[model samples]
Target: MVDLRRARTTPTDRPSDASGKGTRDYRHSWIVRGHWRNQYYRSRGDHRPIWIADHLAGPGDKPLIGGERVNVLRR
Candidate 1:
């Protein structure tokens, strides 16, 4: 038996402006947290499960609602 424990990961901080006021743009936008996934690939005429690295999604902008945050987890 294998103990498939998921690693805990958090979204990296958004980039800040020159004034150091944090990442707050006029346009409403938000950053999607990065996460891991299991993908299947063909290897030697067989399918193998591969672990994909985490990747950030969406533009780095403030959320539409105030104090909104997004968290993603492996499925």
Candidate 2:
């Protein structure tokens, strides 16, 4: 998995997946490891969550984000 804990800087574009899939987010999440927690901001009864990518059967199979793969295509 990508190391988002090192995401002290905001990224304008996302990095490529091992399969070449690209991630998208106006605002990206941090902490690729550690707690598997994400950083999100909410406003006026609305909520927006930042996300990360993890392989289900891969080494990091915690699935804390579950199904919310690409923040854009995720629901």
Candidate 3:
């Protein structure tokens, strides 16, 4: 069971430099056990509850349906 709500925090700038992750380091990541892949999120800093998907990792099997907002579907 992957904890989609659990976020891993890193320095916001770590992704932008030579590391090449470029903004990707600051975002949070979630792994789907069933899909065997990862999902990512970035901070909107809108002072509201929102999460932006950094990028989609898999096919239809893994998708962040709502842009900037992750809707976790539980079956």
The TM-score, computed over Cα atoms with residue i paired to residue i, of candidate 1 is 0.25
Best candidate, TM-score: 1
Please name the candidate that would achieve the greatest lDDT relative to the true structure: 1
Clashing residue pairs found in predicted model 2: none
* Candidate ranking (lDDT, best to worst): 1, 2, 3
Q: What would you estimate as the lDDT of candidate 1?
A: 0.55
Q: Of 1 and 2, which scores higher on lDDT?
A: 1
Which residue runs of candidate 3 sit more than 4 Å off their true CA positions? Answer: 1-15, 25-31, 36-75
Cα lDDT tens digits, model 2, 1-75, are 343555488755779778987764333323343234445455545555555564333234333333444544433
- Backbone collision tally, model 2: 0
Clashing pairs in 3: 15-22, 15-23, 51-68
| Candidate 3: tens digits of C-alpha lDDT, residues 8-74 | 8866555356666554421333433332233333464334434444554434444333335467889
lDDT per residue, candidate 1, 1-75, as tens digits? 345888888737767789976674455554344555555554766555665554444455544434655465656
Clashes of 1: 0
